[model samples]
Target: MSTTTQNRLESRYAGITLEGYPHALSAWFIVALRFVMGGMILFAGLGKLAFVSGEPFDASGFLVHGVDPASPVSGLYAAMASNVALMEIINVVVPITQVLIGVALITGAFVRLAALGGAMQMAMFYLGGWEGQWLAAFDSTLIYALVFLALGAFAAGRIAGLDRYIEQIDVGGEPLVERFPTLRYLLG
Candidate 1:
């Protein structure tokens, strides 16, 4: 490529050239994804619970609309939406889970676990809701799933998150977090 073209391509963004430093965007992207996804989940749950706006929120709408009549699991989601007993249980669980996951991702605490949980939820949604168009409209759920897993695998929370502080604690000559194998696996 011509020097002028190269220079133009390497133009400074936010004062740093991204020419040979693609990962520079990694940190920013992760933080942005974390906040955006976390905020969306948090606000969604809070809205459902009417924690801030006093507007009524219910999972019934999601349950009702999530499934396509032609989809294989449509009967299941439909049944869950229609059945009072199951709906009663799910109504409380879904919102609380979303809120907790949102808090974890936002605070960068137990982010791996949160992301994994979020991924599982998204996968379930995909299985039940997507039916046929897995790539067009419902791909975002899998995207969420992958991003969450990537954040966990990279321990992105430690970059600018509470994990940095939490990881510093030592107990009995070992990090307090080391005591929990699951946490170590997740955070690492």
Candidate 2:
């Protein structure tokens, strides 16, 4: 090698670094992906649980058909209209989910599980988007969901977080992790 190349390589530890400065581009993407989606979920959960208003939603009226007061689930938004208490509880839980998942992403703990949950939540939200309902308001969330699934597929957690710890447990080569091929790429 040339003197300049040799000197540069030596200075850079032969380009070896655990900071994921190189060769782990996808891993870093996953981390960012988790943060963005987690934030949205957290916000949504908190918002729904916190808000309380008796007036029927203009959007809800558009999503569901006419209602018969006698029928609990019918009439525009009758389902939601009847479940004020449940909605409040959901609001609280949703925020908690957002905060916890956000922590997991930021700290790199159980990242796969957190990503999976994030993906599922995104799918549910995306699917629930009907007839220009709140779905349209948050249609962009679908992209985040797809990103989480990709992160899970690549085992982003192992590269960045507690996956290393999980892998250390002796279960005959960690059968649970072994079942997940992405575990192979996880940091050990």
Candidate 3:
């Protein structure tokens, strides 16, 4: 290819600069973080669903006292715990969300939305653990949430994925994307 064409191709494949972000090292680092964190979330969520077959569980009795039906967020947990089938389904859905977020971050497709979703899932997971008074169990979920928040806030996918293409089409930037700039990283 001609030098011009080669350069163009390089820019396209390696990543095109945008507002001084694309190709930034931190962007790639965030991508790697998303990949690892996403996988971990997917694994844990799937494990929760799979626990029934491997071990005995009474979702109703999973958490009591401070986090039980009497606690502040008891209604929410009750809603979740009440539906054993739904909770089980959440297992499949949770991992699927993780897998998709991982794929999006790695491939740079719909990155902002994917990352936001992952963060929300992580927050929920963390809350679940917290309510149960299990900080050790909450740590991983909290970490995943922070990673996703970073990926979303920084638009890491622009470095080498479909996020760039999405940006060109003016579809990636949303209200949530704009809002991310203001949110501090508490989970990381």
> For this target, which candidate reaches the highest lDDT against the unseen true structure?
1
Q: Per-residue CA lDDT of candidate 2, range 1-188, in tens?
A: 22322211112356665332233344466667656665656555444433433332232342244333333334434556356675555545555676666666655667667777777766654544433444354565577787777666655656556666676666665555665666654322
Better of 1 and 2 by lDDT: 1
Off by over 4 Å in 3: 1-24, 42-71, 131-138, 169-188
Q: Highest TM-score, which number?
A: 1
- lDDT by residue (46-149, candidate 1, tens digit) is 77785565765566777688576766677777778888888878877877888998998898887787888787877767666675664555477777778778
Q: List the residue pairs that clash in candidate 1.
A: none
**Local accuracy of candidate 3 as per-residue lDDT tens digits, 131-163:** 455435447768778877777766666666665
Candidate 1 Cα outliers beyond 4 Å, as residue runs? 1-22, 53-56, 134-138
> What's the TM-score of each model vs. the native?
0.75, 0.53, 0.56
Q: Give Cα-based local distance difference scores for all models.
A: 0.73, 0.55, 0.58
Cand. 1 TM to true fold:
0.75
Model 1: lowest-lDDT 10 consecutive positions: 1-10
Q: In model 1, what is the error at residue 97, expressed in angstroms?
A: 1.5
Cα RMSD (angstroms) for every candidate in the order listed:
8.4, 11.0, 10.3
- Each candidate's number of clashing pairs is 0, 2, 2
The local lDDT score (0 to 100) that residue 36 gets in candidate 2 is 63
- Rank the models by TM-score, top first: 1, 3, 2
